[model samples]
Target: MLTDRTDTRAKLWRTASVQRGYFTAAQAKDAGYSYQAQRYHTQHGNWLQVDRAIYRFREFVDLPAEGDEQLVRWSLWSKGRAAVSHATALTMHDLGTASPSRIHMTVPRNFRQQTDALILHRAELTEGDVEERVGYRVTTPLRALVECAAVGEDQNALDIAIAKALSQGLVTQPKLLYAAQQVGPRAELGVERALAAAS
Candidate 1:
């Protein structure tokens, strides 16, 4: 490595350190690494590729690849274009016993990228519907249940999630009802049933 590049690499390392050791290709470029240099570094094991266009410092590459760390890495890979949502948000908020087999995220309608690890739902979210938590953004609890109610597969699980959220004071019946109605009539059934059971 060139001596001059050391400072640039240090800056990139500082950024990646805050993001749980993940940095994107664009971030690397911004930190003065050309595509060729990035490839060389990764090829030489100075950085470890996490996903396409995403890399983690080789020093931190040995960290376990599950739970919140990986979730933060995945979110960084999205380039702030997605917010965790639905069942994943419920799990993050500790509102359910059921764990989703895949992470759930919402991207703007025009955003495109498909991957096996995440189920991406496309919609524009209102500012109030999203909240930042643990260095990443997620849907508000009521919006999470509302989105889950709209497309979630299991009524029993959804009800349990709602009950838990209610008990935890994460959301209220009126707010859930309002969120459901905002998504239209089809979504109302699940929230209504969950509310009934909780009552």
Candidate 2:
């Protein structure tokens, strides 16, 4: 029989548990932990500081795998305003053999976070362009393919990503074409080549 306060703590722990036991300072505040309380937890070794603004509960115990560490940390860094995008989104959607060394994220044009571990693309994302995966937000497969082809310099990689998306029925050629058209001339050439190869 847990008391009300204990139940609140447990609820917060459960929320962070899904995200590799990681939570942001904002989340702590929302869960009724004051700034002083957060510091107290850190000082007492009850919570581990994972990044500049991210903390992990000592007992939450849901560690991320090797490849997911960077993505998870950067996701926390975004504080939910960014969605995984471009090559990283392609990898998340399993649409290509892309192994991006840096995490790619799409933030609104006014987003202001500056970090070295992430490549930021400023875009106005609509609801249809993003999806939640596990506890992270990512661009949809169709949007990811268009983004990869639009900005990616490597034609070979774009070809493979586009082909994978089409073969897997993740997106159709018209969807790619529409997305590319939305980007206008910046994406025309890549989308043309990708369409040819995928079709």
- Best candidate according to lDDT: 1
Question: Candidate 1 — which residues are off by over 4 angstroms?
Answer: 1-3, 63-66
Query: Per-residue lDDT of 1-199 in model 1, one digit per residue for the tens?
Result: 5547888898898888878788899999989899999999999989989888999897776777546676777788678878999989888888757778888999999987778888999999989999985547899988999998999548898889999888888888888898899997767999998888878
Q: Per-residue lDDT for 1-199 in model 2, tens only? A: 5347676688779778777778888888778788898899899998999887699887654544645655666778887788999988888888758578878899999999898878899999999999986667899988887887778548888888888878888888888888888976657688789778766
- What does the lDDT read for residue 107 in candidate 2? 93
Per model, state how many residue pairs clash.
0, 0
Indicate the TM-score of model 1.
0.90
Candidate 2 — which residues are off by over 4 angstroms? 1-5, 60-69
